[model samples]
Every structure is written in structure tokens, then in C-alpha cells.
Target: MLKSLPMLLLAILITSIVGIIIISIYQIYVSTVKQNKFNVIKDASITVIDRCGSILPYWLPLLEGLQNFGQQILPDYPFSLMSLYKKTLMPFVIVYVTNPAWAFIIFFILYYLFVRPKSPIPNRPFIRFNVLQSILLFLINSLLGATFRALPIEFRTSLYGLMVCNTLFWFVLLTIIYSVIKSIQGKYAKIPVISQAVRIQIDNQS
Candidate 1:
């Protein structure tokens, strides 16, 4: 009873914290939308979405299609390996993408507290690589969203740039998803430029 009591309290505390964060975000989003401050919210929202949306290919069929693009270009195995992805991964990914602001805050807090020390888990190459990858991706997405915002609304809304953005989005998304899956399976994806940068950061930390 005593041990269970502490666990119950901890769970309640976590739930309360999460609820508060969500409420705060909801309020901010509502205020921004209501006050006609779309630009401010749009940049932040799209940046987070682009950063985390990379994980969607693992769960989304359209994204998975993009990842297995070669199958479409060539006669190949009619079955998609992505279908074999663990079903348990979807709920977590969906929640993260849907509430990216909250997800990022919660993940950053947990990572800093439990994974950022000289702990052996922190030293793990795969974990370090992914952390760096996520950070870089976030920065890239931020810049991209900001640049998009600078363009005229008509241009932004036009189908002219849609194809380019769509292609780039899926490319980055699938690449990250592939790396994540490989990491989970105890392998490295070894993406060229990104992998090199991740290695440098991990080495410097070590």
C-alpha cells in the first residue's frame, strides 16, 4: 500500500502538469487566433509541425508511400515493410505531432533531466544522434516557416510552390522516420550530411 501510494501520487502529479501545459497552450492559441495574430502563431505552429512531422511516415500510409517510393517507380515487392512497424508506435507519434508544442516541452524536460548527464544512456550513439538530428531539424524547419511567412500570401497559397514543399517535406520526414526505425532495431541509418553533423556533436559531448 505504501509503495503503491507513492506511484499513484506521482501519476497524479504528472497528469496535472500535462493538463496545465495543454490548457495554457490552448489559451494562447485561442487568444492569437481571436486577436487576428495569425503570423505569430503560424510560424511557431508550422515550425513545430515540420520538425516533428518527420516521424509521421512511420504511421501514415501516405507518408509510408513516400518512403517506399522506389516500389512505385519499379515493379517490386507488393508488400510494404512499413506495415510491420509496431502498432504501439502510432499512438505516441500521433499525440506528439498533434500537440507538438507540448510534446517538445515535455520531451525536452524529460531528456534534460534523465538523459543529458554523463549517464551511459546519454552516451549511446543512437540516442545522441537522434537528439542532435531533432534539434537541427527544428532549426531548419523554423527558418523554412519564417521564410514562407515572408512571402506574399498569394504566392504562399498558390499551387506553384506546393509541389516543391510537398516533396521536400516528405523527403525529410521519411529520412528521419527511417533513422528512428533503424535505431529502434539496433542499427544506424547513416544519412550522409545529417549523420556526419550528429557524429561531430556526439563526439564533442563525449
Candidate 2:
């Protein structure tokens, strides 16, 4: 366990780093999109100003000033690719990966009903428990995320709250990946409650 401590810490650190990077990237991308929208509005106004110069002589300069003011005050908001990615694609992927609502249902039905204890596979027990623990972790993360989401948007969007939530998400994801690798190597991952539950179920089956 002492020798593995560093590996565990590294896994967690990697997870946290990934979360930070993704969040930072998301913020940067969104900001870029907003700026782009504002720029587009300003450019369109300038184009109108130029066209009005040829069509209207006396009002051209006044219209140009008003259009410039409007560009500053009422910039048109375009549909950003970042918004689409963050709101639609990211959520779908996150739900599929982190939420065990569907995974748990499918895995349990398949594992218990079809996978027998006396299977010839040498690593069957380890694989079974690994999957169980992974599912449990996913459920825990999903619930945690949901609970955070239930908070007021003001708090949920705060830096501190976002950091905490991201850290949890990253930690669970990295830990699950690490656990899977260990199981493939015929090692038992010592996840506290879930591991104990897996052990109990295994013994009862045996």
C-alpha cells in the first residue's frame, strides 16, 4: 500500500489537472466566441455605414456615429461554436461517461444473469469487482454533479464551487481508469466502501 500511494496521488493529480485545463479552455473559448460576435456586429455596422455614404450624403456621418455607438452598446450576439460544444456536445459526453444510471442498469443485468461464478476465465472475479466499483463510482460522481447543479446558478458558477466540482469529477474519472488498469494486471483496487461491497458479494457467491 505504501508503494502504491504515489501512484494513487499521481492519478488524482492528473485528474485535477485535466479538470482545470478543460475549464480554462472552456472559458477561453467562450470569451473568444463573445468577442467574435461583437466584432461581427461592429463590422456589419461599418459595412452599412459605407453603403450609406454612397446613398445618403447629409445623414451619412450622423448615421455612422449612431451605428458605431450601437456597435458598442448593442452588439449582435451570434451563435458561437463554443456555446454549442459546451452546452450540447460536452454534456452528452459527460453524461455518457460519468452517469452510471444506464451503465449500472445494463451491467447488473448482464453480469448477474449471464456471468456465472464458475466461469473459466482466470481474472473473472477481479474483472467483475472492478466493473462493480467503477459503476458505483460513476453513480456517486453523477449524483454529486447533480447535487451541485441543484445549487443556485450564482453559487454553482462561482470559481470555488466550480473548482470543487471539477476536482471531484476528475478524481473519480482518473481513479476509475487506474482501477481498470490494475484489474487488468490481476490486482485488487482498494476502493474503500465499494471494494468491501464487492468482497462481500463475491464471498456470498462463492
Candidate 3:
């Protein structure tokens, strides 16, 4: 039991890191480049909220800070809205790879030291979702990165199809994951057609 505790903790940490990475990507992208369509922003926000919800009250403050920053900086930008959106989230990119683990550690400490003892919700779903999301993101990103690195430089130069498909697939997957997490929290999550897959997963798990 003692040995398993560390492993379990590590799993939770890794999962939180992946979720942070995904949110970092979305935040940076949206802040730098303005999306004309509301759907795009809504989808991205839902993903952010779903992942952020796990971390609880901390996320709310961080997001509020970001929003305040946006109000101050966005109006002064000269480029297209999309470019501005991307720039805002750029700071988190390095954290995704560098101290990714720190985000999870902080969250775990926060929960264990405070929330877990007071909150009525069971800890199992929260821990399970964090672990599941992190493992999935780690596998997907590592595979994609490895595949891209293994390909010849010349091959990558002409791989627009691969790039496009990968981006689309990632966005879709994020939406699905976010929706599933929301459902698990007993919320009504709507993510177009992808919510069906999340429902299927939840059903199977139960």
C-alpha cells in the first residue's frame, strides 16, 4: 500500500500536466488569433473549463486574471484577432514541456491539503479522470511528435494533409474529453456529435 501510493500520486500528477498542456495550447491559440466563429471559442472554452474544473478555485482566479489581461492588451494589438489570441497564450507553451509536473503537484497539494478534507464529492472520479486524460494526451502527443520527428525533413515539408488532419483530430478529441468530464460531474455537456462517444465511454465504465 505504501509503494502503491506514490505510483498513484504520480499518475494523477502526470494526468494534470497533460490537461494543463491542452489548456495552455488553447489559451495561447485563442488569445493570439481571434476566431470569428463563436463555436470555436465556445468549444475551446469548454475544454479549458472542464480541465480547469478539476483544479477548482485556483483555475477560476487564473482565468479571471487572463481575462483581465486580455481586456487591457487585446484592444491595442495591430494584427488580426487570431494573431493576438495566439500571443496571449504563448507564455504557457514552455510550461507545457518544462515544469508540467509542477501544475499537477500544486493541484494535488491543494486538493489533499484542503479540498479533499472538506468537499463532499468522492475523490475517485476526480483522480480517475485526471489519470485517464493525462495518459491519453501523453500517448497521443508523444506518438505524434515521434512520428513527425522520424519522418524525413523533405517529407514534412509536403505533409500539409497530415498537419491539417492532426489539428482537426486533436480539436475533436479535446472536445470529446471535455464533454465526458463534464458529464462525469453531472453537468449537461453539449459538444455537437462527439458527446455520443463520451456517453458511450461513461456508460461502459459504469
Best by TM-score: 1
Sorted by lDDT (best first), the order is: 1, 2, 3
Ranking by TM-score: 1, 2, 3
Candidate 1 residue-wise lDDT, 1-206, digit = tens: 33334533444455455435544565566566754755433223222222222222222222223322322222223335334332423333334344446434534643573246465442344444555566555555545545655777676546655544555556656765666455333344577786688677766767
Note each model's CA RMSD in angstroms: 19.9, 25.5, 13.6
Candidate 1, pairs of clashing residues: none
| Cα-based TM-score, every candidate | 0.47, 0.45, 0.38
TM-score: model 1 vs. ground truth:
0.47
- Candidate 3: worst-modelled 10 consecutive residues by lDDT: 60-69
- By TM-score, the better pick of 1 and 3 is 1
**Tens-place lDDT digits, model 2, residues 77-144:** 35484455455334333343444243445445535632457644444444455545645554565566
Model 3, 1-206: lDDT tens digits are 34334544544465567657766765666566655444343432234445544543223223222332233344445668647656643343323334445545654654454344344454444433443333333334445455655667665545563454345344534644564445333345555533344345545665
Q: Judge candidate 3 at residue 175 and give its lDDT.
A: 47
Q: In model 3, how large is the Cα lDDT of residue 38?
A: 43
